[model samples]
Target: MQTLYLSRLQHYLFCPRQFALIELECAWEENVYTAEGQVMHGKVNSGGHDTRGNIKSVRTLPLGHKSLALEGVADVVEYRTDEHGVQIPYPIEYKRGKPKSHRADEVQLCAQALCLEDMHNCKVTEGALFYGKTRRRHAVTFDEELRALTLEAINDCRYIIESGITPKPIYSTSKCRNCSLKEVCHPKIFNKNAKAWLSNQITANLNEVRQVNNNDD
Candidate 1:
């Protein structure tokens, strides 16, 4: 089993094709969104630790889980004492933008929790997502639904990596317009042309049937 990057789960949720292109085909192009994200994470990834009262923050913490076959560095992990006075791990993921319409961020955070649980041998019940745009933190719980979604995402990524097939580009002005790989993907041309070719083939098949009827007559 190949070790899947914990970050790729977010990519998979955002767009499976994008994940395939980057992971399988080794294709990458930095657009404004990606560049900004990298810069945003740079601050958090600088590697440091801070203590505030009962909470302690650690940065750029390496994380992995053998069972899940996932590995990556967590942006931050806040350790706090629970009611039992036992220290608990809470992962904090930094994002460049605000909350998205998709569960990509949540899934990634949950995977981090899974890794933390495996590493610490303690249940990481919740975590936080800090968005640069909002400058706010959103708490995420490791519920059954999110865990299942994360697991599904892991399987989806593994399947795509093993299959080594790039998905056909989907043209969406809202989505592809800002995509960094739009030029390489060429969704505008490929999707439109593929649809046109399929239409033409159907038309030609119908025309041939009509011509055969006329010849019989």
Candidate 2:
């Protein structure tokens, strides 16, 4: 019954090993991309308030769903009055990059919406992702497909965290291209025969050192 961090849904979608390393093993590193994202989220998490007509923007709202065992802070939850004049939560997540070819971000946002719906006892039809690169918000409808994917991700994350088993890393052009854990995860080596490769490399380096010593003698 380990509770899953709502934010880690995207990380799990990107790579389960990355998720396990961060959540389970407590391993983390900061690259340029991660740093930028951290800064953005930090700013968002500082807490702010903005009001526009029927919309009230609230930053850093703590959300949790007991049934799903999901807990995290939403970057911004806009309380907007709908046509029915009822204020409903609309979550907006901040990211450092542009929209990717995958639905990881969408799934994360949808998960937030699900949390909001459960917490508020209302229906959330959509949320959004504000990409720094685009400098705009992209709306995401919480369709059935996206909801299913989000739920699946939650279950998968729970399984990984409960088992405390880190999955093997696989090199991905998109997922691992700018991953901060690339060096620690060692996808290229571990995906193949890492033990054998390391052994050969160590032996070769030793032989070269021995040859150099012999020449010196």
Among these predicted structures, which one has the highest TM-score? 2
For each candidate, what is the lDDT? 0.91, 0.91
On a 0 to 1 TM-score scale, where does candidate 2 land against the true structure? 0.89
Per-residue lDDT of model 2, residues 1-217, tens digit only: 6788888999998788999999999999999998899899987888888999999999999899989988899999999998999999999999988998888899889999999999999999988999999999999999999999999999999889888899988888776878999889988878877789889899999999999999999
- Residue 6, candidate 1: C-alpha displacement in angstroms: 1.1
Clashes of each: 0, 0
Give Cα distance to truth, residue 143, candidate 2, Å: 0.4
User: For residues 30-139, could you state the per-residue lDDT of candidate 1 as single tens digits?
Assistant: 98899999999997898989999889999999999998799999999999987888899999999997999889999999999999999899998999999998999999
